[model samples]
Target: MAFPLMKRYFDPWLVRIRNLLKAAQGRPMALVVLFSLSLLNLSSEWPSNMGRPAFVGALDEAVPDSFRTARQLLFDQYQRHFPRIPTAQPVTIVEIDEETLATVGQWPWPRNRLAGLIDAVAALKPLAIGLDIYMPEPDQTSPDKVAANLPETAAALAAALRALPSHEAILARSLRAAPTILGAAALDHATDTASTDLRSAPVLVHGTDPLDSLRRYDYVLASLPELQEAAHGQAMLSVTLEQGVVRHIPLIMGLRDKVVPGLPMEMLRLATGSSAIDVFADGSGVQAVGVADVQVPTQPGGDIWLHFASIRSTLSRYVSARDILKGTVDPQRIRDKLVLVGLTGTGTTDMRTTPLGELVPGIEIQAQVIETIFEGRFLRRPTWLKWAESAFIMAFGLLIIWYVPRTQSRLAVFLRAVPKGSAVLGVSLHLLNVLFCFFIFVRLGLLVDAASIFIILSAVMGCFFAPALLRGDDPIKTQARDAQGREDENDRTGKAPGP
Candidate 1:
């Protein structure tokens, strides 16, 4: 009985929709809806995903640029209102801050002093130490290098200086003392070919090659050979910016035909004593990165959508390098914690603009990534949302194409005074979708693209109503005007007009 009733009501609606589609106006509207669906990649074979051929990829990005920007704005608003609260207490930053720079002397401080700093932190027995700072070149202050530059007359002094161990050796020994992960930088252009052999944590790929999905670098700027040998792990410290701002940080990337983990991922591996990083991917892209018992969800290209927090949050603790070196730092702050060491002084720091609309130290971002992974407070874009949005746009558009013109005749008086009421209805439906997206984001940490829905709906509504709006008069109003004009003419001529 219920099925029969539903069909009785629905069959006529279906027939009406079919008739509407047969109309000349409805044909173009249907085509527009299909075009919008293509933009959202409803068909996978056409636009493909992010790493397609250059022109095709740009077309894909260009079409959805506004949608992406609006989505980012929504994300920024969400972040401001309810940023992720940092719950991983064992992550800390050992900052080489302004005070440390002033106290320990300017950067490029002799490697031995850096060694002392590392030794001090190592003494606290941190679970893992990450050097977000890099030493791409060997220290020029090494005793032998200084000795080689001196005059021959100062051979004895040079010999005495050379007799002592080089500062680099001291630093290398310090690195060995701690389970330290050294930083490497991914470069777009080839520099020295020597660093190609830089050691990296092993990455095990599962299901399909992920090279296309991962960010690629032509070369790498690795640390000194001795330092690389001493460090337990070496990983890229570089980050890819999104529209000149930092949003998602890549967890794994392609470097010189090799897959390597980023700084935070390596640190997590070291902390957990994980032997290797596992990347789970499909033809679409990377799904997640596995480190020991923790599985971290990622963007298709192995990037994690960084859940930002206020800089003042205690999600990660910070301690001054000077204090650590001076033994004034609390031991408890470093005990069993994953410590990231980097410069935070102005002019020498790695600054990134976060979604929270603040410039943050890159090391702090790494800290947040580590905490997010461990605590599993990830913001994800579900794979099905594009299809969901596309279905919504098409279904709502079909409804408008069928219902609007039919209602116009019945609601002539109300619509004539407000021709834009139809457009207003479209906007209200859009707002409802936007609010639903917001609710999903708040309740489940899912990032939905409200902009796509709006864009498609706007196009459909504009096309549907443009002809009526531009023509300036509909048949009903024209007839009413004609009747009124005949009455005026009859009164003027003193003759009755035939009905």
Candidate 2:
């Protein structure tokens, strides 16, 4: 039969393979089995990319100190890269620092003083000025005076949100001249319950109660409701961090089925004239909103990638309220700038953990958000990435098995074949897909561990096939290797060695 004739011609290869099978006997199958399980486990660990609590908790606990240090490094990198890139909107801060506090009196200065500060900032004609401080109530009660009875104490301590109207009046005047955006935090403090008369923006932030960690925020007490009502956008100033480190932020949250940007994000979007900023969900990866022909950069989960400038120095570099109030700073400084108002106090604990494993300052995080929105450079790892990884892993592993063993020497063949063929091909493809978003083919938005799967499958294939090519001799089997070496020498020299 033709089959018999083909087998007769390829008998040497068949013998080598059979010999390898006999050598493997019972030990080689474990690699593939274990590898498959690992792949499955990895897939489940990050399913839908929402991130599991157990895994996040594990990372949090296992790498506690790592978070802060990592954030610092990333922040430094961003600072170095920022000026060179020339972002459209430069981030600035109008801080209510200790010096300003001294000039204007201690914490919660009189409503008129803040109102004057707002007016001064407005005079500079900045694009937007955000008030990081909350105005839940008017300074009706003088805590320093110390009230006697509980009822009298309650009455005296109850403050009106005088700052709201004050800021609104200032904003309205300034808005007529230029653009402006104000900040408001979701309520956790008791002060927000006080003012029914103070106006609030109609839009609200919405999110689920994940472990009730966020349940504390019940409402948003804006300093200027009337002004905010007329403004182009309003955003949530809330930020949750891991171990006091911030790495990522919510671009938008569902509040009453409407999409408004988060504090920094909204401000940046408003500054750039983009009404609808698509904040890709942790669930959806990345979806294009109704933007016209605009491409976006994104993280693996399709959100804007969080990057930061140096937080430590940023706090010190703040433009004080005193400067703005005194007319020393140019309106041009804030003119057309995207301003973010966030607390950097050590006592505050809104932090997040990131890949760099750091607890970054919340304000630095806002800076990152502003930068991303304006630059339009987002982070994304799309779906075709997943299929390409699976394909490359399978093909490269199989080809490595099929080709390398055909050479006369197993180790040498492995090294050469790996460089020229499967190994290089696999590694190159892997880096491209994971790092640069190459497999834009499927657009499915999934990714796998190319290096991991390849390592595992390669190990299995090596066990199954390589030994067969070098059968009748393993390097460790001295007697077999010696006999094969002798045969090889004879063939090369055209004579047997004199023993």
Candidate 3:
């Protein structure tokens, strides 16, 4: 009796709900609901939190990190396959490979040996030499230092060794003679309070103060005073990584509260003999970095999106240090090129993975940066792309929602003849959107988040189609219902139903 009463009361309400759902699948109301959902999606992705309420943080967290990560991975795949033919051949690497280490003994080779290496490279007259090595402390291998550690039994020998000229002094003379840029390491933790001398290129700021937009360092690990003062310039030998891959290198960064150029930027400055670097910025942050006549578009924090060439490309030449030291280097190879000196030995710690899946020396990345800037082939992720993606998801989702319901309406008789035709139409539109994003990336070098667009649309399609799937109605269901009604009529008339 209770079941009968419950069904009697709920059946009318269930019919009303089914009727409401069918109406929602039509115009005006469907568009409004979809538009409202699209706005909610866009609200969560607002770039800045300035004008929003407190709950936005919660909403943002609701969007899984996996989605953003997948989006980045998709972009990485695009870059990996993209063909980038470098137009400029401005950088060459002087690699200290396994052969060099074996021939010249292990790394931290006596500063006197390094002095000879510098002299050899300088004799060829490269445009500028960048030493991508950090010499934080005085050389312990210096004769004087070695003598100081000797036992009293070797007093005479110690005295003889100490009498020889200091190793750093010899290296300093070589550095003074060559146009060299010494590499400095960036540190996050503060060290000595007394400020040591730091060399920063003159930066002309055009828009807002960029101090806040730059990557900050508490201290800089610079070379010894003698060698640092002798070098033409000192720059940070640091790189910025995303997902453990070297994708962008900072052109300029903050060190000890002062702006200093990165290794690549300093190399560019010295090669072009630029007096200062011009930085253009706005409310959005740094827009570009200009050195002499070469201006590079940069991300907000003075980082350029690196356009990495294929590993097989010989655009940038690499000369072994062993060859350069042995006087076998061709003058044409080093002449007028910005030479970067770094270790690429098997056991070296500076090896980093590139987007191309090669483990390259950190110095090679710096060379790539210089080449990218010189060629002006930049990959840009514009600020407006997010809004455009949001709009696309809304418009495309609304279109599909409108199209799906029309497939069953008398107004779309052709569509009604096809079984589940709306799904097929929606999938085609999705494929077109994917191809459109690919074309934009290939033709314009624009980085669009196609993954997010796909995710949003897929969710919208799933939700819109879910109710109909749950109802389990089709041409077969309508025929079965008609047969059941006939059987009921036959049973009421006391006539046996025939199959």
Per-model TM against the reference:
0.84, 0.57, 0.82
Worst 10 residues of 2 by lDDT: 205-214
- Name the regions of candidate 2 deviating beyond 4 angstroms: 1-38, 41-89, 136-232, 239-245, 256-258, 272-285, 289-302, 309-317, 345-360, 399-499
What's the CA RMSD for each of the models?
10.9, 12.2, 7.5
For model 1 the local lDDT of residue 107 reads 91
Report how far off residue 304 is in candidate 3 (Å).
1.8
- The runs of at least 3 residues in candidate 3 whose Cα sits more than 4 Å from the true structure, single-residue gaps closed, are 1-23, 26-66, 190-197, 401-403, 406-416, 468-499
**Which tens-of-lDDT digit does each residue in 368-437 have in candidate 1?**
8887877888888756666566677777777665554442244434555665655565577788887888
Clash count for candidate 3 is 0
Clashing pairs in 3: none
TM-score rank order? 1, 3, 2
Candidate 3, residues 1-499: lDDT per residue as tens digits? 9999998998787666545544544344456556655555555555431355656556666653535566667777778778577777888899888999999999878899999999999999999999987776778889999999999999999999999989999999999999899998887766763134466667788888777878988777788878888999888888987778887788888775577888887888888898778888877678888888888888778887777886578534889999999999889899999999988888785778887788777877888888887787888875677778877778787776666444334424443556656557658877877688878888988888787777766766555444354466653343245446666898899997643
* Pairs of residues at least 3 apart in sequence or in different chains that clash in candidate 1: none
Cα lDDT for residue 226, candidate 2: 52
Model 1 stretches with alpha carbons more than 4 Å out:
1-30, 33-58, 61-66, 192-194, 408-424, 468-499
Please say which candidate is ahead in TM-score: 1 or 3: 1
